[model samples]
Target: MSRIILLIAKFSAFMLFVAQVESNCPSKCDCNPYSWDMNQIDLDCHRAQLDTIPRNVPLTTAKADFSLNKLGLDPGFQLKLDHLHDLRNLDLSANFLESTHIKDIPDSVEILDLSANSLSELSLDDLPTNIRELNLAKNGIDSINGCSGESSIQSSSQIAIRFDYNAIPILTRDTFGNCSASFGYIDLSSNNLHTVEHNAFRGVIQKANDSLVIDMSYNKLEIVPFEAFQDAIFDMRGFEYFSLDLRKNPLLCSCNMSWIPMMLDYFQKMGLKGVIMGTCYGPEESAGRHLEELTKAEFKSCTEYSWLKAEIKARTEQRIMPFWQVCLVVLACPGLVATVVLIVGVRMHVKDYRRYRDYVVRKKRQIATQRRRHHFRASGAVGDVLLNSSIKNSQK
Candidate 1:
């Protein structure tokens, strides 16, 4: 009878432990049997018609998978998860979230999967410093906030961020300026990005401290600004090994592409391997020819004149031209004025001399006329006197 009682006691203890584990799970959830070995409860409640997260989650749970659930919690409900201090991994993918549930997340949560949701905009100011892995794929996020100055993510030693298929239109300056991570990768594919500003990846490259990979493919980008990749290498000591995947972009094939040749040469000389995955979107003939397969003849055929290139060259030449052009203009201006003044003075002097000569000629003509008149008067007087004497002698 004693042996039978001991066996019953052992069975009862086991049942009690099982009941305790089951009770720790939410009322509508199921606990995996194998997950108990790690002393953590793994609850799977996917596709459940849950509107809000259940408060009865097991305290010892380290990971929770709630993917594909209809748990469309109100924006206010994100703050409620702060109570779950022990959660390390939380998967809320495919729920079609609209915006951030709350401004802050639990500090203890490390890995967060919010992929395939409807998040349009998010701010990282409220995130805890201990966060490591963050998956935000398929969201409508257009840009990264606080990517410069003091608030940039200078180091992701414990953080990995993924942003794929978000349809981002443009990447502004300092977009990822301070991101620092030993091992980091950014996926900016299948978006509407047409331009990447200078310093767009400053934080990420700086934080990488020598290890980083950036996947920027399947976008509408026509040009990658030189400054965007200026200091973005793994290290400045030498050509650091880094990966850049630029595929499916509409590369404009023109003389403006001189920059492309220069950039490729720079990367090759630095011992870096960068891949250009797609062909050029040139004029009609070579619209979709791959860049790698293109020969020099084909490239020359596709190349066209670029006004921007001409303008740049013109401006550069103007900047470097000697100051003598300006100095010559300045020096010639006074000479031109002096020549005009001398010509005017000579004309005035000639007019004055002509007037004086005319006055002297008129005076001489007047004197000669007066002298003839006087001579005629004197002759007439003598004739009158001779006539009077002759008349008197005739009368006598």
Candidate 2:
């Protein structure tokens, strides 16, 4: 009888205390106590036709889904989520938010989604300290706010950032200079990215400190800027599971893409642990082919010209290269033949001069021999005639 009385009193306290907690919930939002976390609530105000966030949400809200709303249309809609100490994940995607001047988001919120909006500029000053993953896809963002040294963004841990499907046309070295996060995952895919200048990710790609994954797929790149990624490849070589996805880019696959094969070979030699996906999409012969799988004959045209005439002929072969080499030789042929002919003529003249000198010496020796023979014959005849005259006088 005493135990039953005690149980009735405890039940009445629970009904009055715990059950009345739902009475303060917003009319448009559903408030449910999360089973995983004690006393924490999950607020679902998504697609509730709300022009602003409900102010009556419980302070113990752990997760909030405020997506698909008209929050940006209201000028007086001031977002203040720092009061919710237990908030972690917040989905504000598709809200048509334009500015990132939000200053009240708490550090407790880690995953923030601002995708499918009209955000033209993103500032690092708007993010939370404990944020791990931030989605800014399809925002048509033209520039980053903190990159001009207006402010600095510091994060306690490595963050994964997504800026995919935006209006970014070029990436310079100072693109992400304001964000001091050692970001492990960066998705810059699906944009008007035509060029990534050298050292574009200078601060972003840490030096052998952490693993990284970069997605630059589906862009308007005609050349694979090898100079821009030299440091990135060196930094990623020590990592275990990194990836550089350049697939679906409209690469020219000409000498312009000559760095593709060299990068693959170096990636093999360095023992870098990752997969690189790149393919050519134009010039007909190299379309739909992997960058590393192309033959030396395909890249043979790169060696054909003197680096200046590379654009003379598209996909010229080794046969064409030799023709230019032969032309160079033909241009030098007259001077080479003249030099050789002059040397040969000089040698022949020297040989004829030596033969003439030997002939003159032989003619002098022959003339002296004929004179000695003539004098000896004349003396012999005179001696015989005198001997006959003396013998006739002695006989008389």
Index of the highest-lDDT prediction: 2
Clashing pairs in 2: none
Error of 1 at 45 (Å): 2.2
Q: What does each candidate score in C-alpha RMSD?
A: 27.2, 25.5
lDDT of 2 by residue, 70-136 (tens): 8777666677676898898888898867765345677888888889877887777677767888999
In order, the Cα lDDT scores of the candidates are: 0.64, 0.72
Q: Give per-residue lDDT, candidate 1, residue 274.
A: 51
Clash statistics: count for each candidate = 12, 0
Cα deviation of 232, candidate 2, in Å: 2.9
Model 2 is weakest, by summed lDDT over 10 consecutive residues, at 310-319
The digit string of per-residue lDDT tens for model 1 on 1-396 reads: 999998898778656656877877776678653343445566777777676778887776667777887655555544356666667778888885665652445667778888888777756554444566788888887765742344423234535677788867888786665544333567787878888887777655443335556778888977676466556652432434556666788876554443444444444544556544556787566678664444434334333324433543553455455578879989999999999999999999999999999999878766765555555556688856765555455445
Clashes of 1: 12
